[model samples]
Target: MKYSIRKLALAGVALTLVAAACGDDGGSSTKAGGTTTVATSTGSGTGSSTTVKNTASDTGVTETTIKVAIHGADLSGLVKAGAIKGVPEDASVGNSRRIQYYLDQWNAAGGINGRKFESVQITWDPADPKSYQTSCQKIIDAKVFMVLSAGGGFPPDSTPCITVDGKTQYMGIDAVSAKQFKDQLGNFIGLAPPGSASAKAGMEILAKDATLKTAKVAVLRSDWDFANEAFTEVDKVAKAAGINFVYSDAIKVANLPTADANKNVALTVEKVKASGATSVISMLNFTNFTVFPTEATKAGLTLKYNILEISSGMCTSFSAGQLPPEMNGASCVTHWNNFRLDNTGAKATDTPFEAQCRKDFEATYAAVDSVGKGYPAITKTNPGVPYPGFKDGTGTQLDMDQSYYECNIMNVVKAGITGAGGNLTKKTFQEAIYKVGLFDVAGIAGGKGSLSANKLWLASNVQQVAVTVNPDGFKAGKDANGLYQGKCLSPLACFRTVPNTVTPLTFTLS
Candidate 1:
C-alpha cells in the first residue's frame, strides 16, 4: 500500500497490510516511549456465526438498502498536469467499477439479511488537505453507513472526521497506527496490520536471521507518526533480542522543502556509513526509501537493505526503473503474497481466494477495455497464460495492486456484513468482526485474517523475501505480442519469497 504524503516530491507512503485496532483492557501498559491501554483478552477468533436480533433501525439502513461510500482519490488531474505519470487517466472510476462489480454480484445473489448495498463514490484530490476534509463532509452529508477507503489516499488525521465526528463505520486498506485506531473508537477497521505490529514482527524476524543477527545494523525511519511508532517497536524488539543498532536516526525534514529533505537523507547516509553499519533496516515510506538508497550509493556507501512492508510498492518501482539499481536485491518482511511470482509460472500457485480474485479482476477489466475506456485489459498473448498485467507488454504494475486490494477489501466488507447478522449497526459490525475472528482474504498470508477484542490488525504471518532480477525471462517465455511471458520487464526484478521462511506474526505485548 503506497500513497502520497504531504509536500513530498514523490507520491509514496508505506500502506501496509490491513488489520483491526487494539482493544481496551481497562489497564495501561508501558512501552518504550509511552504508556498504552492494552487489552486483557487476546481477542483471537475463528470465523464463526453468531445470531443477533433480526430487527434493524440503524442509521443509513433502510428496510431494503444499506448505503455505503467508496472513497478514493481522483489523480487524473495529476497525470494531466504532468505532475505524475504512468497512471491511469481516471483511477477512481476504475477502482469504483471494480468494487461495484462485487457489490453487484452480491446484490444479484440476494444481499445480506434481505438488504442490498447502495454505494456512492466519493473522489478527492490527494495533494490537498482541504480536499480530505471536504470529502469527509461529503460522506457525512450523504449519510452513508460506512466508508470503504478502497485504496491508499486517506490520511490518519482526516479519519477522525468520518469515524469520530461523523460517527460512521470506516474500513480502509491503508496502514494505521495502534494509537490512531484507539482514537477512532470502534468505528475504524483497517485492512493492513498496524505499523507497530509490522515493525515488531519485521525486526524480530531480522534479529533471528543468521546473516543479520550479529551484523552491525542501522535503523532508519521518517518522522511520521506511523513511522515513529514502528521505530519504537523495532527498538523494543532489538533490545529484547539483544541486537544493538550501530546507527539510528529519523528523517525529520519530510514536511520541509524537497531540497532540505534530500539534504537530510544525504547526511543520514553519511552518518550510517560512518557508524560502520553493514546493514540497514529501513522503516521509511516508499518515497524516502527511494531517496535514501540513492543517496547512500552517491556517498559511496554499500550496505545490505532490510525493508519493512510499509515500503509496500518499492518492488514494483524497482522493476519499473523508478528506483536505483543499488536496490535490486533489498529484502522485505511482508504479509503480502508476491503476485508476480503467482502470475508468472515461477511460483505457480495461488490461495483459493487469490485465484478467484484474478478471475473476477480479469473479467471486470476485460469489460472495461471492450468499451474502449482506455483501461488496458489483463490480456496475455498466449491463450494458456493464466493472468497477465500487460497488453502487448506495455502496462503498469499498479493494475495488479489495484485488483488485489479491491478484491480483498470487498471480500472483507462482505465477510463483516454477513458475520454481523440480520440486525446491523456499527456496534454489531464491530462485535461481529471480533466474534468471527479469522476470515478469508485474497493475496495475504494463506488467505487467513482476524480482528478481535485485543488484536485490531489482521495479518497472521510474514515471509522473508529478497528482490531478484531474472537474467532469463519468465519461465513461460515471451508471447507473440512481445510481452515477456513468465518474466517481468527488462532488468526483470521481483520479490521472491524465501523457502521455509514463512513465520507467524507472534509478538508479546509490552
Candidate 2:
C-alpha cells in the first residue's frame, strides 16, 4: 500500500459497507478549543450492550481505512495576487510542507496498523459551496473508512452523498472549529482546541494582573455565539475577583462599508476609553481585528492589557501590522504551535524536544518521492501569501501555523498507532484510540515511542499561552518556553501566566 499523490492521501484498508448500528446523543461544545467526539450512530441502542465482533470471520476481515482530507483554505483572490499574503492560494512552502512531512512519516511507519495512511489535498473556491459535496463523493468513491479534517466536500449547492458507510466525519485546519461543527451537525468530533478554552485561558491571564483585574473591559466580537459564551466565563471569573466589566456588544453590521467597519472599531476604542477599560478581549478574526487597533490608536486609546484570539495572531491575513505602540506590547493567543526551537533562556527549555520533531519532519519529507518535496527550516515561517512574519520579534523568527497543527495531528496519529498495540488497521485501531489513555507508536519504522498519546487527560488539556510581545522588553516570535520570564516593560506588559495551569480547571456544567 502506498500514499496517493493526486489526493495527497495515504493508503488505507479497502472500505466496506456496513449497516447503521447505533450512535450517541447530540454533540457537545465546551469552552476550550472545542474537542470533538465521534461515536457509532447506526442502530438505536438504549443502554444495551452492543456486540462488537472480535472474530475475523464475523464474516470477511472487513478491512477499514480512515481517509483524512484537508481542502486548502479559500482566501480572496487578492491574496493570490500578492495584494495580501498568507492563504492557501499562495501559502508558504513550509506550511504545507510540514503537513506533508508528517503524512509521509505515518506511511513510512507501516501506517496505521500496517494499513497505509491516506490524505487528500483539495483546492476549492468558497463562492462554490457545492465543492464540499464533490470532494466528499470522491472519498466515498474510494470507499475510505472515515474522513478527517475535511471540508469543501461538495458544491455548496448540493451536499450529496456525503456519508461514507454508517460513519462520516469532517474537520479542517482552522476554519471548521470544534464548536462550530458541533453547532451545525451531530455525531462528528472536531478537535481544534475550542474557542471557549482560548477565551477562558485569555481571561484567566488578564485576571492574574491586578492592574488589569481592576480595569473595565469591553468584550467585543462580531459573532456572539462562542465569543459570548467564552466572555461569559471571563466575566464570571473577573467578577469573582471583583474586576469591573464595563460593556460588551455584538458589533452588529448590516451593511458595513469600509468606513462603517472602521467606525465600529472606533466605537469599541471609544467605549473602552470611556469606560476606562484597561484591557480589551476582542474575539475577532484577522480581517475585523485589522480595524480595531487602528481605530483604537486613532482614538488615542491606551490599553493597560489586551489579548486577541487565534485568528488575529496566528493566521497571517488579518492579524499583524498597523497597530500603535499601545498594542506593540500586547499578547495574542493561538492554537497553532510553532515547532519548538531554542530552549535557552533565563529559565528551562524544550530545545531537545524541538530538535527531535524538527529532524523527524525533515527526514520524512526527504524520504518521500513527490513533486512538492522540499526541505523546510523549522524557522521558515508558514507559507501563506505574501509571507508575513510569525510575530514581531527583534527580527523575523520561525513560527508554526496550520503546519504545526497538522504536525500535531501527525504526532497524535503516531500516538494512536502505538496505542493499537501494533494493530494498525483502521478497524482494530479504533479500539486502541477510544480506550487507551495514549496511543504509543513505538515499534513502527523504528521511531521513538515508547511515545504515549499526548491526549489531554481531560477536556481541559488546553495548550497553554505564550507571549509574542512584551512592553516590558522581551522579544516577540521566539518560542516562548519560559512562560512569562523574559524582560517585560511591566508585569502586565508581560503575559500573565495563568494559575491552575499545571492543574487544569475541571469542566463541570453546574
Candidate 3:
C-alpha cells in the first residue's frame, strides 16, 4: 500500500499542466511604510476590484531572499525494512535534485524581484505518520514563506500545520480533496485536478459509454478525505445520469495497519460479489489497483474496473506484474496520456517542451553520474522516444513521471513569482497564480491547461484508456539486471486511449 504514495505523487504532477500569460491589474498602486498597495481586479469574472496590501514584513521574506521548504518522502528506509515495495532507493534524491536544478537556474537568472530563492530540503519516512507532522513543523520552524511538496506521504492532516497555523503558502504536487483546498483559506495549491473533479468525470464517462452505462456498478472508496470527496461526486453523477449503484462502501481500514487494510479489502470484495455488480468504479488511490483486484480474484469475482484517480501508475502496474489477472482489461478515466500505448496517434508524441525537459534531465543525470552518484543515465538509443518503459543499466527505468512533474511544478512556481510582480507576498503570489490564464504545458496535450480564481486546479481535461497486454514478446536483449527491455511486449502492457472519450473538466468550485 505504501507504493500508493509514490504513485499518487507521480499522478498528481504528471496529470497537471499549467502555463499562462500574466494578466494586468490596470489599476494604480503605491508603496509606503514597508507596505506595497495595489488595486487589482478580483478575477471572479464579476468586474469587481479590490485593494491588496503586500508588506515586506511577510514571513520568510527578506531584502535579498525568499525562503521555501521542499518536502519529499524518503522511502529508502521502508524499502530496506521490507515494509514497502517497487520504490527506488534514490526516489527522494531524484526529486530533490530536479527541484534544486530549477531553483539554481532561476536564481542564476536573477530570481523574482531580485530576491533569490533559498530552499531548505526536508524528507520524512512514509511508514511513520508522526514524521509527516514533524516535516511540516520543520518547515514552520525554518520560517519559510512557502512549502513545496515534491511527492506524496505528506498526510492531509499535517497540511494545516503549514497553511493554516503557520500561515504559509503550500503547493503540493499531489491529489487532495476539494474541501481541503477550501479549508486552507487560499493557501493550498494542488497541481492535479481535485478528487471531486476526477471522480465526477469518471462517472460521466461511464454514463456516456454505451456498454458501461447499463452495467451494474459497485462504487468502492477509501476512508481518506480525498477518496470520500470523490465518492460523493460519484453519487451525484450517478443520480444525475439516472444510474443506480448496486453497491457502495468505504474501506474502513484505510488508515489502519496493513493487516487490517487487507482484511477490509477482502470483506469489501465479498460484499461487492454479493451485490451482483458487474463493474466497479474505484475512488481510492493506487492501492486499489494492487490490492482490490487480487482480493477480487481470490473470491472468483470477475468485474470490469474503472479507476478514477492515479490511473497513470495503475495502467502501467498491469504490465509490471503488480496487478492480478482480474485487472487485465481495466479502464481508467484520467488526465494521463500513456505514451507506451501503440495506437494513440499524435497523443503519444512528445511536445517540444517535453523533449527539452528530457534533454535537460539527461544532462543533469549525466553530470551526477560523473560524480559516482550511481544514478541511472539516460541510455535510450532514440532521443525522440518516450521514457515510460525504457530500462536503464540498473534494470530500473528513469522516472519520467518525476522528471515531468518537477519540470511542470517549477514552471508554475516561476509563473507565480513572475506574475506576483515586485511585491512577493503570499497574497500577491496567490492572486498572481489565479490570474495566469491558459498556457502551454510540456507533457499535457495542447489546449488542456488553464488556471483562474474560480478554477484552482491545473488540468483541464480527462481521457479514458484500456489496459491490455501486448501479444508480441520482449525485444532482442536484456538489461544489466537481466530484465527484458523494449516496446509493449508480452508481459508488458499498453494503455490504449478509448476512442471519443476525451472530456473536459467542468471548471466549477464545489
**Global lDDT scores for all candidate models:** 0.63, 0.40, 0.61
TM of each candidate vs. truth: 0.76, 0.59, 0.78
Off by over 4 Å in 2: 1-66, 75-89, 92-94, 108-110, 124-144, 148-167, 171-192, 252-278, 308-325, 331-348, 351-353, 364-403, 417-431, 439-505, 508-510
Candidate 1 versus truth, CA RMSD in Å, comes to 10.1
For every model shown, the clashing-pair count is: 14, 58, 0
User: Model 1 has how many clashing residue pairs?
Assistant: 14
Tens digits of per-residue lDDT for model 2, 1-510: 221232323333233433212212122222121111224445775333332321111111122333555444344443544333433343423244555666666667645444454666544433333444445446555444434442111221122133222233333333222344333232132233345555665567567777766567776665434455566666677788777778777775322433455456666677677876667766665444556666776788766535535322332212332233455445444333232211123321223444455455444334322212232333332322112223334544423322223443455545554444322234334445455443222111111112112222112332333333334333343335423234321111222222223324333221
Cα deviation of 47, candidate 2, in Å: 32
Of models 1 and 3, which has the larger TM-score? 3
The TM-score of predicted model 3 comes to 0.78
Query: Which tens-of-lDDT digit does each residue in 360-401 have in candidate 1?
Result: 766766654531246556442222222223333333332343
RMSD of each: 10.1, 11.6, 8.4
True-vs-predicted CA distance for residue 214, candidate 3, Å: 3.9
Better of 1 and 2 by lDDT: 1
What is the lDDT ranking, best to worst? 1, 3, 2
Model 3 clash pairs are none
Worst 10 residues of 3 by lDDT: 14-23
